[model samples]
Target: MLQEKIGGEAAVDARALVKTFGDKRAVDGVSLTVPAGSIFGLLGPNGAGKTTTLRMLLGIIDPDSGTRSLLGHTQPLDASSEVGYLPEERGLYPAMNPREAIAFMGALRGLPLAEGRRRASVLLAERGLADWEKKPIRSLSKGMAQTVQLLGTLVHKPRLIVLDEPFSGLDAINQEKLEALIRAEAADGATVIFSTHVIAHAERLCERIAIIAGGKVAFAGAVDDARDRLRPVVRLQTRAEDGAWRAALPPGARQVGREWRFELPEGGPEPLLRALIDGGAGIDTLSIERPGLHDAFVAIAGASAAAAMGEGAPE
Candidate 1:
């Protein structure tokens, strides 16, 4: 598929967006750039203003003070035909069949009914939903219905896709299917930006991410850059329980059942290994590990925010 390029290389650009609802500030000074054809993530706990920020960027609502460009258009809605948005609220008319439902959604995006129907059939077959294509949405399982909606979002093969909380309420199998679908879209040169509080999905899917907390952006950049905020950790096991080599261990080192763990020393592990060898500590095993996305999120967004992610979907 030939992607319709617009507005240079960036698919999305927002600068200092702010939104207020009554006495509460829903979003504050949020800024980020999403590169075209890349998979980006908007990560945050519920009530953190991720939805509000996305709404502003999509031109669904105006920002109190900020600027945004979508697909190179200063007005995001102008690019609606090129963008596919799956909102947080998942709904389909109970009377409509999967094929009809998908086609209807595509029609809303300006796709002709015939083309949309053709694409919907292909999509259903590809997703193993061919047998259910003619079944009314009310007769399908929740996951199946959601899959139909997702296929509808893609029938037009948009250049930019924005999904808000795409993984919520999905079983493990459905979530994996959604992940594969997302990957396939990006591979076809479509830019995908999804919002999620689940760190695992973002860790696997996003090349870059914006971590929001309390209506503010705590960090935004490459996934690796975020993980690099903390030092790598060292986990070691020694044959000798105690020795002078122990003195070489860095501060904050802790021993647990014949194993020692600590942050990697500032000078690196080479010196520590030498000290262990010379002192006959008899190293059994040693390994250095970088922080994962979950750890990075906790450090960047605070433990409270991480806790909220595990609780449930945000309001």
Candidate 2:
């Protein structure tokens, strides 16, 4: 069980959630706790039960077993007015203008139509879409339509926001804009939960993450804790080509060009540094490299999950 931070109440709490369809167990004993006013990522490869778990959390579908709470509501729908959701499948009436579409979404969450429209106008201007506010959804580019939908999700100013695969189909510029929007929401005290197979976004944005693979939670905790599972790598460049200090190198250490690279020794780097200096091995450059989130994901969930991320996998 993860410890909740002081004064940080859980915005979403799920325990041992399981869902089955026919003979396939889509989610098995999955659990997660997202603190309020924080960004959490539900990370996994495609078909890794991310969508299924999210559905169960939102009361869109009930789990065959286990329990969940959303914003302190035992029944997720009871808190619907305080939650905003953007499903992976995007949908908007093509004939409706951006302002109307946004206002319509707000209306679904119990916001008055007139107030929704007012908020929509302000949101559009803030997002650099003021000129397109009155434009029909079909007349806008795909990216613009998606941004309008995202704005619609926020027009009601919900305390909790859930976005499923929000970055899909977006170009680099739009993706950056979405990232900024997410940050701005969190800055204003909204709890943001987004699911994606891409590790870069999670690593860059989330304070905590739950990695699901093969329909189970492979790992869930702080981002740094996940990376700490692997030892730091050491890269060294020395003035001496060969000397008594060579013995100080660990067994798996290898040399390529001018640099020698290996994992940090079990005892620490101090002893190795002392041996190198004492034996006249002049150290030109030395760097201790911490493993990144991609490496941590590969280590925790296996290379298969890493491959599932495809080109989005960090280098």
Candidate 3:
């Protein structure tokens, strides 16, 4: 079990969450917890029921079975004012100007129209959309419109923000901007839960992550803990290849170019290092590489999930 870090109650919690559509189980027994003031990622491939899980947690859809608590409210709607959700389906009135669009969304979340408009103007200016604040959503670029929508989600100053596929259609520059915004929100003591098929985004921004595959939680914990599932790898370069020194290598050690790469044994690298030095192998360089989140995801969630992420899953 993963221990809660932020004290008090969890910002968001779901237990054995289940959802179904006809005969197909869209989400099966998914569960996750997000600590307050932390960036938590729900990572999975497309159509992996990530959206379904998020919707259920937000009270946007009823789960077939299971329980959820959002911002300490058993009924998510009771805390709706404190929660902000940006769905996978992006929608904004094409005819509405950026400021109007933002204020409208905020209004739906129970913010006063004047206050929403005020916050919208400030957010638009801060996000470099000041020049286009009066322009209709139809006139703005896709990236710019998406930014406006995200600003709307924040206009009400929600304590818990849930974003679904937030980086789906963003360019490199805009994606970086969004990442910074998420970090800023967490820094301001808000809990951010974002779902993404892109592994790199989670690897970069998430302190904790729950990887879902085939509608199930494959792994859930701190990023470091997930990566720790795999052993550290050792790469050594040596000029000596004598019979005595060969015995010092681990069982699975293999030569690739000038380096011998192998997984460090369970006893640790000290034993291997000692044997190599004692055997007089002319070691030029030795380095241990820690496994990354991508490796952990593949090892834990299986290759199919990794493959589904496709180009979005960066090394």
Candidate 4:
């Protein structure tokens, strides 16, 4: 399928990307487009080829087949200075102070060392790490070190930022802070893409998302479009017992406690309500509940992905 480009030129455009390790096909024919100035999410369970696809896009590893364009450059290395990346594995010089560490990363991306240090001071102060800026990275907590590394990713103010499993070890508070930081980046007109197995972060932060499973793209598009694949559920509780009125219930209706829960069929709830009333049922309550991203993820990615999610493996 031809990948759809958003906003004229995509920040990242990858087509038919494939990768293999020995005999195992790690990534097979994945295509994705991330619009400029948007928060795009690559979501999948562990070992679903998300990291492989990302590595290919960043020119870290060659794809067995397919092509990619990053920041309008067909060759990612040509635009390397314009992109900031945070790998799934975290690394920072244990002996370096937070300020020096951030500046060093920014310097590698072409930002002047003095300016990098200036921005680092401002960022650290704003993030409530002012007192810790002079401390060695080894002295900071895990969450603090993660935050500092993320600061490094943003210090150069690249046009595109890519992060892999960014929230892997963050506490609830740090996760919230990172979410806000991602929004702030997009707000500043920088395109952002992050890979994760967690659904909540994607649901809350991304406007568009791609779901991958078993080394292939299962679904990709707007979050709402994915959710719309499944219809809203209609839950009804009627005082009437098993009778002609019971036949008015939807085909998939099943009793859950006192309520009959089923998906709302075509033509919507009005028809269902009319059918129940016409059949002389005493309606106690009725509700139409929209499905969330979790429901969409389950429906699109299948049982195994959902099971992995339940196990907290990656999704």
Candidate 5:
């Protein structure tokens, strides 16, 4: 059994969540765990089975095989009442006012009608939609509608929030606000599982995440762990005219713009200047270059795919 975190319960847990469409395996052998009060990001390239996994979790679709539990409920629908799901496809009644629409959604989440209305009003005001509370959905802008969708998902204060592509339509201002909301939710002891193609969002908001590709997990764990796996090196600068040499560099080191940059692979953090001098690639200035998450992602998933096809052969 996967042990839950301290002072926490297992809010979402799955073991080999498998699903298929005809002969295509959508979510094949996907197992994940989301502890209470943490932000877990589901990341992948387009059509990498992200949506399929989420759908299975939401009970909107069922898996061909495997088991799942959310909030202690074996049946996803029973668990769903305790979940707030924001799908990629934005759906809203354009004619309904924010107050009305959100209340309806809250009621579905098990909030009493009267309490739902009260919560909707407070939530709308908190999200800066107070001025537009009475405005019909059709009259609102795309970002506003997106906000309403988020409000509906959250108005009932579900313990688990599953947000898919939550930042798709928002401007920078609203994006910041939405991020705040996500962080706040976790602070208040909610378990959040959000998916997105945008790596930075996950990198910023998630304590841990799993990257899926071709219906499998390419990487999963804490943000620091992911960074360590990639091991982005740092770059150093030394000028020939202004300076002499940086000194002994490692293999795969390159000199650019009067500075030498070295790629420090994992478990190989040496005193950079000494290494440069020892390698005979000495320079006046030294810079260490580390690969960013995007580069690491491309390197791992792309290399994995290539190796499978025997194309580049993981070179």
Candidate 6:
């Protein structure tokens, strides 16, 4: 099969991309493609270069090396019109009202002033902020401000949306609402990529994820595929009791608290099942506990972190 071009079937395609600051390499060499109309995640711990990578995609900063294509345009700033971006910092002018603020954002993206206001009106109403459309931005609560910021990002109907920690200030209710909005946007054929440190948001929203560490993509692919690639580990437990069963487990298992989990590297569950039975262990229950996104995140980034520290992972 032929390899797809960067953004060939994607909304954002970045290859061997790099950005540096003085002596520090902020984004080393990272390549990623976010498929059109899907929610993609870029994740990492602090200073892992996710923000820099995003900036390069947004054309806010030039990459020291490599290529990036967004929404059928390459290199030049005009390609930016195809995107909507919500930065990590809350960017609404404290004094500007929602109508003016959202419209200003649209204008930056080349929307006509009147058109931007028209769209903001409809989007604000749809987002349940209709009553506050004329209210000063500073008067709105954090959650309400977040809603308006989102309105600004989407008012122009860009084909792609890039959000940086979009849920930062939201309460649970607003978080759910915002997530629903994101999904709705994606369903309407907009590609979405959001960078976040919170695991749950990524787990809930992203179909594909890229784990970045020390300026590299530690893991990249569908969420399920990444976890499955790690191992098919199952946890067996008896009645919620904590004991020395971990020490008695087979050499292949890694014990977590009161559970024993392991992947049958070459085979299925039969050998492990037979071993459990043959050992005459108290078998209250057996369950295949698939690795959560957080687990995969830690495992993937952990190695990279160790590599950056110039030593193996701590014992």
State the lDDT at 144 in candidate 5. 88
- lDDT string for model 5 (262-297, tens) is 566454656655554555553554345455555556
Q: In candidate 4, list every pair of residues with a backbone clash.
A: 197-314, 197-315
Candidate 5 vs. true structure, TM-score = 0.87
TM-score against truth, every candidate: 0.95, 0.95, 0.94, 0.95, 0.87, 0.86
What are the lDDT figures for the candidates, one per model?
Answer: 0.91, 0.92, 0.90, 0.90, 0.78, 0.80
* Top lDDT model: 2
Query: What would the per-residue lDDT of candidate 3 be over residues 228-266, giving only the tens digit for each residue?
Result: 989998889987867577787778888888888888888
Which of the two, 2 or 3, has more TM-score? 2
Model 5 residue 73 distance off true place after TM-score fit, in angstroms: 1.4
TM-score of 6: 0.86
Model 3 scores a C-alpha lDDT of 0.90
Q: Which lDDT tens digits does candidate 4 get at residues 125-229?
A: 998899999999999999999999999999999999999999999999999999999999999999999999889999999999999998999998999999999
RMSD of each: 4.1, 1.8, 2.0, 2.3, 4.4, 4.3
lDDT, residue 95, candidate 6: 93
Runs in model 4 deviating more than 4 A are: 1-3, 311-315
Model 1: weakest 10-residue lDDT segment is 1-10
The better-scoring model by lDDT among 3 and 5 is 3
lDDT score for candidate 6 against the true structure = 0.80
Q: Which candidate do you rate higher for lDDT, 3 or 4?
A: 4
